[model samples]
Target: MATTASTAAVTSLASVTLEVADLPSARRFYRAFGVDTYVGLRASEAPSTGFRGFTLALTVSRPSIVDGFLGAAVDAGATVLKPAAKSFWGYSGVVQAPDGTIWKIATSEKKDTGPDTREIDEVVLLVGVEDVKATKEFYVGRGLTVAKSFGGKYAEFAAGQSSPVKLALYKRRALAKDLGVPVDGTGSHRVVLGGTAEAFTDPDGFAWQPAA
Candidate 1:
């Protein structure tokens, strides 16, 4: 986060707005993707290439739910960046939207406790930052409280009950690697974060606006 020191405004991440080229197509895609209600959309021709320096992740209770989300995304015209698979952490998959936004569906649980259901545990917005320590300091300097910190590698902020989206930071290259994308990217990030603040732009050029 950057600019004026408005603690309350920048503290909790309230919403996410994705700038897309075609509103109709994007809406249709997200509607099929089962996350349209979680995000706001606007039409913009921002010329972004390669990785966008951020990812919106869906955390679920089991691997089957992860498979369900990823599978739906694929059936809805999303490109598979990484197939659903288990890793050291758990099961997950990566997909690219038709409008070029990247999404991750994952779970820390290895197996399902019961039948698979479309239950999303949480939605996290992870921004790829240049320095996790510095950014952590920046957010902490505001009203944001740190929920978890891992050296200079990553940081997650505690979100209020009113906040629908959680904010987190990770190293740029490492985030790209985790998202299965190249580390090279240029131009607008094409995504805006909405919070209590009227408007602000982060150090990496991620914009923030007031939640509608």
Candidate 2:
């Protein structure tokens, strides 16, 4: 995506993953925002990759690890969809969380390369919501710069302006229609960056900056 002229060069971000209850919900959510989708998992049963030039893993079943964490998270206000357990791959597993609209928790797959190392690229998400004006004001009030108001229907903002994070907004229904979906937001979803601190809300849902 082409960034604003004043914005500095942003480091590339890798793929963004959503742990959803149903694949259909994911399709509706992203389709609304005009995000390109592709078949992720390979014929060999590996994770999905290559969407819009980024490697994407649609869903990963890691029961062994998820089960232990689900117990702790539920006690802290998380709505559990499925309890974690061992998966087919034999690793710790989990694949359910429906109520927590914001799921910024990091998965086990990503590694922390530290601030000095350049391992991950940046991520920019296009959010679809019910209201455009309200969404724009909400994010701007939270310290995000409105880089450009795309004809008053969509807006793009730097994730942190300096940190390699980015966020984009759009009307949910319109966005869904553009992406070939009727509507969206039927399941859990989140956009996470490896290392940045930012948060904001669009018309339909909330978005967090770099993962904590």
| Clash numbers, per candidate | 1, 22
Q: What would the per-residue lDDT of candidate 2 be over residues 1-212, giving only the tens digit for each residue?
A: 21234433223222334434455644553443222232111112123221111112122223322333444445444453333333343322222223123221123433222332212233345666566777677555544567778765888775553433356677666655433333534423333333233233234544334543
Q: With candidate 1 superimposed using the best TM-score fit, by how many Å does residue 20's alpha carbon deviate from the native?
A: 0.4
Lowest-scoring 10 consecutive residues by lDDT in candidate 1? 1-10
**Model 2: worst 10 consecutive residues (lDDT sum):** 49-58
Q: What is the C-alpha RMSD of each candidate to the true structure, in Å?
A: 1.7, 15.9
Model 1 / residue 130 / CA error / Å: 0.5
| lDDT of all predictions | 0.87, 0.39
**Candidate 1 lDDT by residue in tens digits, 118-147:** 888899999999989988887776567899
Quick one: best lDDT, which candidate? 1
Candidate 2 residue spans exceeding 4 A from truth? 1-17, 20-123, 161-165, 190-203, 207-210
Q: What TM-score does candidate 1 get on C-alpha atoms?
A: 0.94
- How do the predictions measure up, each by TM-score? 0.94, 0.39
Q: Residue 126 deviation, candidate 2, in Å?
A: 0.4
